[model samples]
Target: MTFQYSRSFAHQLDEQDTLKEFRQWFHFPTNAVGEDQLYFCGNSLGLQPRTAKQALDAELEDWAKHGVEGHFHGKNPWFHYHKFLTQHSAEIVGAREHEVVVMNQLTVNLHLLMVSFYRPTASRYKIIMEAGAFPSDMYAIESQVKFHGFEYDKAVIELKPRDGEHTLRNADILDAIEQHKDELALVFFSGVQYYTGQLFNIKQITEKAHSVGAIAGFDLAHAAGMLTYNCTIGM
Candidate 1:
């Protein structure tokens, strides 16, 4: 199949897209001369939603009106603020509502989850992860390993692509899991590589990890809104 390759063709497709109206819900940045710029950085810092200003204004109004009472008396009470996001967030990530929770930033959440999942033992204490993971993930794993009284060099296994290659092969990843099964305590990886844009086979990786008696986890910073997966499944 061939796709039309022209600005007019692209515009025509966009006009017919059912999600086209959603674009107006976000506030896009402008250039130096005040022309609307085409932004594509949603993979990192997403553009602010147009409704955000109204939401923030309402919060400010509540603070001014209720002061100490604002925690429980407002359009959206602060005490249960995160609850409003649970269902929508679960839908976005294809997870059950109970399986998801609104939390702090990505790295902070990773660290929090790691605290519960990354249990390292004297005999089975190794962590397997991609070599070129985001610095935050690498840092989190390194700190966890060190805190567990294990040296980073000995306890962390970084899987790399073959020489002259840019991405990890699925077979290589599975083979590494099997090869290091005995000492593996955790298998952590990214849903999508940050730099290379390679989407890993998450389900397979998770299964491989489980087969080896290891806990499987992923840093979904680059994957959350960009990819879809069935969280009800093992992955």
Candidate 2:
């Protein structure tokens, strides 16, 4: 099981991977010269699925045939389109069907969810999050705090790695929550940090946040299909 730095070793591992065949499901990017490019930027946009063309064509055809009636009648009714994705989406995130709702853009959904959960009293108005969070999340938290007449620095606790370190330690995260137990109103974080590719310990973070009477929330933008784990990971 020794790891080697060679093309043959890479091929060997790929040959043994159980998920090897899944790669063909998407069309990888190709350079202008017709060479396939390596892509790892799933944080923002994922590779287009090969079936996307056929799928879009089907929907377009339905729209042309049914017109406005497509909302009520079609291969997949637009009125109940979200329902069609509910079960599978719920299963992927390890949440009950009732707890999951697929709607709105990510930033919009994030802002709405924060508004509902982040009720900040003067006494308990601090939010804890990773320092270099996704830009949308950072802006969302900033606006939420500002909307409530609180300054970003005073209201939000941006957790940073120690000197010379690249990622956060579990103890540091838990300790921060404990330290701000009294003032902590919300523990908001990205499910998988886009910059560092660090998949956090969600369960432990939630437990710590709850032990101190604070609520924990996650924006699983990159984690829904990108995160790879043997079992379910949830709050």
Candidate 3:
């Protein structure tokens, strides 16, 4: 059935939604007059959940009562801190529990992933990326190539749209990967382009990279919680 495009239709759908109760769990900002505001910037910073405060308070109580023992004795132990997130994170990203881990911020994770996957050989030394990537990615890749004794310009292949175009075409991306296949050691792209908000063809991109013997990696800072796609990292 086609979804009707009206406020009443939206409200009807919301009323029918099984997960509607979850919406009340999130904390929304309100104006001075106490009207709830519509927020569209979750892409940048997600709003704090109402339950988060209670969870945090419980942790504080544990710390006050147990001190360092809280690491082992708390409701969610700090000793295996990352374990708390693994299964849920895996489900969100559509991966196995063993295939995912939560760590530092986006840049730190990018550097860590690149450290293992960005190994460069004499012939296969180039990295293919979007023309205007998030700043952290551009910096990390540049520094990585330079650390391996290759000049930035020669070692990094950035794919840009044709003149008068704002976003990349899939054909152009595939062609670029094929054209640079011999030199490409890795194909790194944003899961969703931050500037253009473009969701890439992840599966085809990975296949192309593998066909040409290049490892594929993705920066999912913007993609996670925004949409679902199958992604293989460090392969």
Candidate 4:
């Protein structure tokens, strides 16, 4: 069979997509010459929505109009500001409102999550991750393990793809989990591998981790908005 994914076909697909309206909400940037540039790096920094300026203006107006009172009295009170984003974020992550909190930046969030979830005892004190996880995640895990007084070699396990393979197979991952069942404390993986764009079998991996008495979590920067996966449902 021949593949049909040309620009015209993609535009046609966009025409029929239910989320077509959302495209209008974003402010896709153009090149210096005024041509719309292909933007495939939303995984890093997303395109700003056209309404962002207006939103910022509203916040500035609040600050100007209310000063310190803006914390409680402004149109968008800073006191409850994060709460406004919480419900939408919870829905996106497939979590209960109480289970989700939007506070810091991505790596900061990862570190905070690890503080609660990566509790390592003498016996089960190892954190397992994919070999080529994002640099920020790698740093967070490494520092957390070292901070807990465990040697890097003993505290962190990196799972590599088999020889000649560009992506990991589900069996290989599960096998690794089985091999380290007794020593594993947490299994953390990117929801989608950033470089290869391979989506891990998060639910299955999480199930195996739980079966072996390990906590499981994911860094979802690449996967969010691209596809829907439910962590709560998987749990």
Candidate 4: global Cα-lDDT? 0.86
How do the residues 158-228 of candidate 2 rate in per-residue lDDT, one tens digit apiece? 99999999999989999999999999999987778889888888878988898999999887877887655
1-235 per-residue lDDT for model 1 (tens digits): 2578989888888988999989999988999999878897876688999999998999999999999799999898888888999998888788889888887888888888888988888899999899989998899899999989999999999999999998999999999999999999999988889888899889999999999999999877788778788644322
**lDDT, candidate 4, 109-163, per-residue tens:** 8888888888899999987889989998999999999989999887888988889
Kindly list the per-residue Cα lDDT of model 3 for residues 1-235, writing each as its tens digit: 5789899998898899999887788899998999888878877777889989999999999999899999999787888988889999988888889988888887888888888988999999999899999987899999899989999999998989899998889988889899999999999998899888988888888899989999898887788777866555334
Decoy 3 TM-score against native: 0.87
Candidates in order, TM-scores: namely 0.91, 0.92, 0.87, 0.89
In model 2, which range of ten residues has the least summed lDDT? 226-235
User: Number of clashes in every candidate structure?
Assistant: 0, 0, 0, 0
lDDT of 2 at 173: 95
lDDT of each: 0.88, 0.87, 0.87, 0.86
Give candidate 3's error at residue 235 in angstroms: 4.4
Q: Which has the higher lDDT value, candidate number 1 or candidate number 4? A: 1
Question: Cα deviation of 126 in candidate 1 (Å)?
Answer: 1.0
lDDT: the better of candidates 2 and 4: 2
What is the number of residue pairs that collide in model 4? 0
> For candidate 1, what is the TM-score?
0.91
Q: Give the Å error, residue 167, model 4.
A: 1.1
